[model samples]
Target: MRPTKGKLLGILAATFVGQMALQVGVIQDYWKKNYWSGQGFAESLSPDQTLLQLFGFREFLAGILWVRADSFFDEGNYDAVLPIIRLCTILDPKQIDIYATGMWHIAYNFTDEEQRSDRRYIPSALALGKEGSRQNPNTYELFFETGWIWYHKIDDDYHQSIKWFRQAQERVDMLPARRNLLANAYQRNNQVKEGLEHYWKLYAETAEQYEKQKDIYQLFQQKETLEQNLDTMIVRMVQRGWLAQERGEAGQRVYDTTEPFDVGFSARVIVDEPKVLRVQGTWNVLPVGTRIRIIVRDADNPNFTLAAMDWDGQNEVVLDPERDATFMQDQGFVKNRRFNKRIDMSKDPTMYPFARKSENYLVEFYYNPRSASLHVQDKFGWNGEGMTDKNFLRTDVRKEFEWIPGPKAGMFTEDWKLAERPTPPARIVYTALTLSRDQILRKGDWIDKTPMVQTSNFDASRFSVTTEDIIDVPTLRSSAPSPIAPGEVKKTGDNP
Candidate 1:
């Protein structure tokens, strides 16, 4: 059928226009998704701008903001940089550097600035690191950086640091530096078992690496240092009574207190024919005129004083010829007591009744100057007959000590026994001996001017050492076999 030309032309033009409009919409959507989603584009356009104007430039915008943030950081305008950095992170959430650098600036640089009084800075920095990790869950750097902030910058909380460090460690990309930091954190936190585990792991790995390299000399040095550290840690644990022991052995424990004074006390219960308790340790460094009072009392009844002693530093006489003669003359024959003493319970009859009681006891060492004054006057023949001003300066110390015995089980009256002590791991002792052997061989050559012996053929490698060949005694091992790898020799040497 014949149609009008005007109607046909109108139809064609309308169809072409609609097709163009559809193409324009597709282009706009692509631009928004690929380009305009980031912070730079958002900043470039006005807040009231239409959605079309805000589309398709986010990555470019994020890059621009990152540059500006870096400049702000260099200018010491940390506060100004934070928002920009945060915006950059939001725009490009996968950028690991943004999170690490931003958090570092906030936590370290900002807090270390001259006007560092803003208490909110640290927590805010921590929050930012957390958010960054949340945004990129697979990244280990963010977690490690966050842990570093907690360990070094904020509260020196090893627990929090170790937690995050461990999280980072779970990732395969974790750095060796992070592992070392974790080991240190364990040691500093007094988690000795964990520390030893890490140390031994590191030692084993280092030995394996060094053995392959045939860098035996450096390996010897490294092993020696590690063994020394292990020995020192063991001694410290034993002194602190952290190590387990049998019932008949001495029960030792160390206490750190901050009530009457900042001091540490090591108490040991000697399980002899007549069990005796000994308490002793160094106290806080005090001023010259400071006085300390040591008191033992029944835990259940504080009124019952078991033993008492007064230490007056003012009464101390310096015998050094270099001191002022006049000052020496003024201070009488009473030696200056530094508040370090080993008090024996068996020798003190007054302490026997309290010790025999099933209830626990308390030991207090405090700064009581007035009490010291009274003791000084009586002992030094002053009699306090004419002295009008009896008031003496008193400084309150901030440490208190208390000890309690184990309680009987409820409903069944049986004496509570100490928990079994953990036996030191066999690998630890084996490693120590191996290290000691290397050290001795190295020193023996140096001293006797002999060629270094082939360590592989040494008798110590077979763990066959006579008493005469023993160096320092290796720590006791558990009943379990040593974890030393097969073909790895346990060696010992003469003490050097």
Candidate 2:
């Protein structure tokens, strides 16, 4: 009870030091190394953890509040955003934005990405609005914000966005047409038919969510007059005979060691056949903002694989295009992998290549190179590194096609596109030239002209080709590249 002043002071200092030590290693700093690890802590951390930290349940989380706050804002989880702010102010009362907006509008109505711009925060937002209104009641934004979230960001009741807006001195009036919003989402997704259907549904449901609908019924009915116009004006791509089947030309050629090849063959290989292209590149137009990956490797070179891919909207897509090699900052994952990799990270934005694909793409990276491996992979879709599938050169084209190890699993199909006669049903074909580097180097030196025979996974008894169509394919041979003089090329040492 009778403690000396010096003793009391010492105890206080110790407590302060202890608090700092524990805080230094908090969740915020725990991921300083993973700043750019593509996946951030928030991605895995339960929203509750973020909320507790945001509310100041833990002192160490302060460092990452801004980012965490932004993350919450981006998610438009208004229900959670407000509570966290209330807790935050208890710890740091003067945090202006936290107090001012913690729940102001759910984004105009906050959403997974967009702010419920029209909606305002619940109790807290209302409290602030009340306070703000007293000081500047003439301004309407504060009052309207409350309703914005209720109308749009929540279950999507635009009626509320309008209601609150009306209470304000000035209103945005027209945010987005209720029906048009759905239409826009569909159109943006390239689902025109679906979008049109929804647009009509909206028209039928409400002329305008906020406006009158007496005249809407008459106008919407007129759409029936343009029924024929609903049909797409785009031309159809039609082929005849074998062109319609996978008889050797169904899938896009990843590569073919055949010269104007037929559908089937003995073994899928190049026995001194210079006429056959070693590998062909069949590209896929990747969507924007989505992750993607592609891998091609030798049968023997299992340590690593050489892959080329397109990202619909990563760093590569943002950077200006170049004539030489475009820098691909983003790397995607393979869906299937036998091993697991441990990764450490930091707090920066992880970057990768992202290019919007307007249509089918074609980017050939390697040639009739050698090794013992033959695989193709794309994993961005999966949470893992990526997906991979093993392919082969076969001697039988009529057997059965086995599903490769990864995505789109099925039976293997030998001589998929190089076989003759019996055409398979395919919209496109995928082929790869399976040859060793040593074998290709001896293209004309020690090669044989006899076509190799192979077996296929196809079972005619299983109903030849299914009702489902297959991707069209082609047999392509690589063109010889002109020799480049080494001396003419500049080197790092040459610059010096």
Measured over all alpha carbons after superposition, the RMSD of each candidate to the real structure, in angstroms, is: 27.5, 23.0
- The C-alpha lDDT values of all candidates are 0.42, 0.30
Report the lDDT tens digits of candidate 2 across residue range 189-246: 2233444675455444443432554456554453442232233211110121112222
Model 2 alpha-carbon drift over 4 Å, by segment: 1-194, 205-496
State the lDDT at 429 in candidate 1. 4
Expressed as tens digits, the lDDT of each residue in 1-496 for candidate 1 is 8779998999999999988787686876777555443323354334644343334665577788899988887787866887777676666756778878877776555331122322224555666676665555566788788888766654323455766676676666775445656765665443557777776776686677677877567666665666676676566445433453323333343211101122221111111212122222222222123233333333444222222211111121111111110000001111111222333333323213333232334444333221224223221111111111112211112112111124652211223333322322111000000112112222343343322211121222222222222221223323443344233234322100
TM-scores vs. true structure, each candidate: 0.40, 0.21
Q: Highest lDDT among the candidates is held by which one?
A: 1
Residue 187 error for model 1, in Å? 3.4
